[model samples]
Target: MSYPNPNPYGPPPGQQPGYGYPQQQPPSPYGAYPGGGMMPGAPAPYPTVMPGGVKAARVMLFVLAGLNLIGLIFAVMGLGSVSKASKNASEYTTSDAMTAMNVGKGLLIAVIVVIVLFIGAAIMLGAQFGNGGSGVRVGTIIFGVANTLVSLLSFPFGLVHTVLGILIIVFVSKDDGTAWFNRPRY
Candidate 1:
């Protein structure tokens, strides 16, 4: 009779080598990515961490929201004043006074609506920075453009908004910001 193989690592005679060892898979034809499992020539994966510029943009968004809140408060106060002025104007029979009052009230209401929208957008976009996708990037750019334009109307106080909006646009439009927003979630 034949004796068993002397080497413990080797398979016994008449038995397959896989009996006690794992089988090796054939090498893939394509080269592996640096992280492995990825196909060759694919774009590099985005970074997992939030980039500095993106973080700064997010912070600026929140700040812009805060400023918008202040504007909302002022607009509301102005609306109240307009209502009072309109009431006093109603005492006069002249259509001119009434027309002016109505116009002032309408303008104040419009300003309030716009301020509310700006505040909502700033908070929503700022909060989404952690998990937001490319849409967030696009939304931010649009928001920046709008903010800059709106700030032009207010001049002195809006100067702050204009500066912040410009900075946010710059930060979010950079390469690192794009990568952060494009990064795969999960």
Candidate 2:
């Protein structure tokens, strides 16, 4: 009877069925080969320690800053209510003390900034006047007067801002540890 070829091509007489043939391996585009050449079962690297949380403290700080800002806005809006609300005996009717303080302090800061601007401008104008610039004398005088009036009007607001800034510094300073400083929101 006919039999299948022992090899696809001719084979030597003493050669057994699949003797000396190389074993087939799975394909790999990467240079990795399965054998002892590379360590096959090694684990990937991992971080030893997790990062610390400081988000809470930062949020509190930002909130305090925003309160200060809101206070300034109120002072600028020409609301006489800040003082009136502050003086009210009933807690419900009166403005929150912290809110009032922030607004007042912000007002104070605005006044101080305006005063600094005034002083700088005054010095510049004085120098120009000294240098024989007579043309700007009237304009300088007008600026000085306007600045004084504006600063005077903003005094109450500045006082409020100062108080709030002090409060914020005090609270933030008291919270010393990273956990305290980084208090979580909510």
Residue 77 miss distance in model 2 (angstroms): 24
Q: How would you encode candidate 2's per-residue C-alpha lDDT over 1-186 as one tens digit per residue?
A: 656767666565566756776556664434365552433554323212211222232233344345434544654544455455455547554456657656875675665465455445544543443232223334443553454355345477445434433433343234232223233334
lDDT of 1 by residue, 60-161 (tens): 999999988988998899889878877866454588878887898899999999989999999999999999999999999999999999999988979999
Runs in model 1 with CA error above 4 Å? 1-45, 90-93
Misplaced by over 4 Å in model 2 are 1-95, 147-186
The most accurate candidate by lDDT is 1
Q: Each model's RMSD to truth, in Å?
A: 10.3, 24.2
Span of ten consecutive residues with least summed lDDT in model 1 = 27-36
At residue 85, give the lDDT of candidate 2: 48
